[model samples]
Target: MEEHCLFYLAALAIFILMLVMTFFISSLLQTPPRRHKTASLPLPPGLQPLSVLGTFFALFRRSEFDVEPLLRRLHSRHGPVVSFRLLSFPRPPIFVSDRVLAHRALVGRGATFADRPSAIDPGLIISSNRHNVTGAPYGPVWRALRRNLATKVLHPSQLRVYSPARRQVLDVLLKDLETKSSGGAAAVVVMESFRFAVFSLLAFMCFGERLDDEKIRRIASLQRELLSNFVSFSVFAVYPKITKLLFRSRWKKLLDFRSKQEETYVPLIDARRNLLLRRQRSEDGFVYSYVDSLVDLEIPEDGGRKLKDGEIVSLCSEFLSAGTDTTATALQWIMANLVKRPDIQTKLYEEIERVVEKDAVVREEDLQWMPYLKAVVLEGLRRHPPGHFVLPHTVTEEVEFEGYRIPKGAVVTFSVAEIGWDGAVWTEPMEFRPERFLEGGEGEGVDITGVQEIRMMPFGVGRRICPAMGLALLHLEYFVANLVKEFEWMPAADGEEIDLTEKVEFTVVMKTPLKARIVPRKRT
Candidate 1:
């Protein structure tokens, strides 16, 4: 009986495999239809002119982590726009790298191009299939969620109220740095410290309570576990029905991670809720927080339904994860650049010193006075954005740009790295020169948002632009200044140079974590 059962199970597995292969072959032989009434126009050039299945199989040979180099090569060989078809996908995703084309697609016709991919959005899973700002379809739900965050949590007034929390987190970061760099230790890994700093700050804003280091670190670890598993075009990129049936383990893993996250997040969220209720009864005021804002928001589209606890948890998790990793990764890259080039570091340090006393803490208000510091941050983001592409955008309707047709519900991504380093936009796209942003320089008055023209869109542009752009910029500026002011960052003393090579995780991070020597500044 056992032998018979084993034989039947093995045969069943073989049957499923054969069915999938047969479907793939049949799809490959069929010609795809154009979105418009016109005959099929030529797609932007890529590896080969294969049918959808062949293209997917060829692309599948490259792992999720390996897409960047492939994309770079394709953009080099092909023009600004490149297209690739996926298995069973309705349309091929078009990647745009040209500034003019990007501006045209992402900004000029923002509305038509603003919707997210309708099928199997990874964020929907991560967000518990609730109304998440990043992954929700462009509609009344997304608009309401985004507006709540924008007006209540990320507004200038709200950020101002959270300034004290930022300061407290900065103190935690400085102490950690001090402990690591003390006793003439070897170069310390900067990424870990950077992660702790940013995560701690976001946690405070999200929970409306200052968590101890241990609790915050636990949450950070779990969140990283979830994000590290989520690579672009991984299992979630496929059709949802097939993914659920065939890739059930992946879904299970995501749920397990979400479970672990809730274990850490639920208490905090409930505490905030109870506190808000208590305040309502006792008439006691409290500082604003992201969760507090979320709790109070009533969705008009959903018949004025308030957010559920699980939805709140998902939103808070997204807030913490999104804000922490990207900011931390950008901070690491910027600091690495400074360490790699001491001349730039000295110029920034001098500028910082000139603006404020040596012992003074760099305040948020003081950032504007330092042009070199601002230039350094901009240069870092330009050279190495946290992610090479923004979250994949979906077109709500058929659109035409520069003679190329974009079908409705197709995925579109813009290459941030390619555009930022385009020689046509910058004098030397590869060089790390902050002075380019000064008067009469090629990058003078450069707009990070490509509203006017997409010279370099690091944080993206148009209606779908990162809502936290202002806060992200402030975090980068504040931390970079303080770190530079606190220590004279130097390359590792053991003849090891700063490794600028990037490996994508949740963000484009240093392949070799940044470890650098630190000499405490006398003023610090």
Candidate 2:
């Protein structure tokens, strides 16, 4: 057994060595593109531009999953806009932390920086060759996908149609919490419940029907499996042809996961298709779903053909994923803060009481009148935006900004968390003060869309901003208001204080999942 173990270790070491050699050779063979003589702008300040090995070692020092600290350090040391190369990629990727530069790049020069970098194998395969909105290159296909979502589903009027679904999910969540809390006798770990509830809501929106607990749990489990192993799958993205062969088990796992996803989602897509077919005959009690939109969408860029089943599966997967983990993560952070700061919780509850009548559930219409609820939600997003960085964006053509020449096809990412926490823009940025967003506060009249200027963009900004931003805000406000109004959230009795320490997953979640004592609020 010892001999066999030694033999396997030797084989692994040899494989790694060969992989490094291959990278080195590729790096040497790739020639740098010549810049136009008229456009001799320097690249952003970064590590020694010519040192491929140094760049590799620098990236090696930081875990790919948690690069926030490394990026923070780089921004502090080299100023806001930093650039560095990775492996054999032709151009160095730029990381922008300054809000001003972010505005200029993402808003002012929006078109130039709207394109997405070419996807690696995992992204390409999972997105069905960039068929989904988030993964598609900035082109006709992206426009079509995004327009469908924004117009047919995410538009404010369309979102109002899902209020009943939201209320039903909220009831389930309250029941689950009430059961676990046991009249404040027990402390409940709420992240899983939050995640499951949000997934259930999104699943309903995606499939246009109420899924049973078993099916919702099954689908959520599959998605959680994918997210949990996402970083591990990155191994298959690098030098995929070789790594897929070398990491055979991981490759098989990726394929198996995709197969399972297709198996699960295709039936739902077909069901929606069948519903569409029947709608022509009897248009009775039909609610339009996200899948229905995808089923009917014809991409002008793709020869006007309707989306294939694989693409629909991918689109539905994107819809569930984009809405589920991020919103659930935000809910956990917001509720955790409420538990930690009873004063704020009390203030928010008072506002809810003033707006919502006793014995009546908080309604979507009631949310519009609750200013403090919006403030609390905004503060949660500002302090703990789900993603620390936006998805990497690429340049459509060479452009110059802030004296740096951004080459075409170069990857650029903005620091969403860092920008939100900018001390210059936010007062006592680290503290959770919802009052800042109230009237006569620093955050008053702040536009999250970044149209005028980017004070704090939790949902991002500019053309590529999250299309579902309105829906997400509505969910947050409605859920937070109802949760606070129904229960008094307090620190767990088990001596576990609310810990705000963060850990990176699919989103930045509480390092310690929130376990809070909940007492049902009395009504007069």
Best by lDDT: 2
| Regions of candidate 2 where Cα sits further than 4 Å from its true position | 1-34, 37-39, 48-65, 280-284, 494-496
Q: Which residue pairs come into collision in candidate 1?
A: none
| Residue 271 displacement (Å), model 2 | 1.2
- Candidate 2 residue lDDT tens string, 1-524: 99978975775567567767877898788686675652678888874453444543343333443567767777889899888755555578899999998999899989888988888787777899999989899988899999999999998888877888999999999999999999888988998889888899899889888999998888888888888877777765455786677677888898899999999999888888987887652565466889989988999864688888999988988898889999999999999999888899999888988998878889999988988899999999999999999988999888887878787888999999999999998999999999999999999978999988998988888879999999899989988988988999988874557889998878888888998888899877
Every candidate's lDDT: 0.81, 0.85
Candidate 2: RMSD to truth: 2.3
Worst 10 residues of 1 by lDDT: 56-65
> Model 2: which residue pairs collide?
none
Clash totals, every prediction: 0, 0
Question: What is candidate 2's TM-score against the reference?
Answer: 0.94
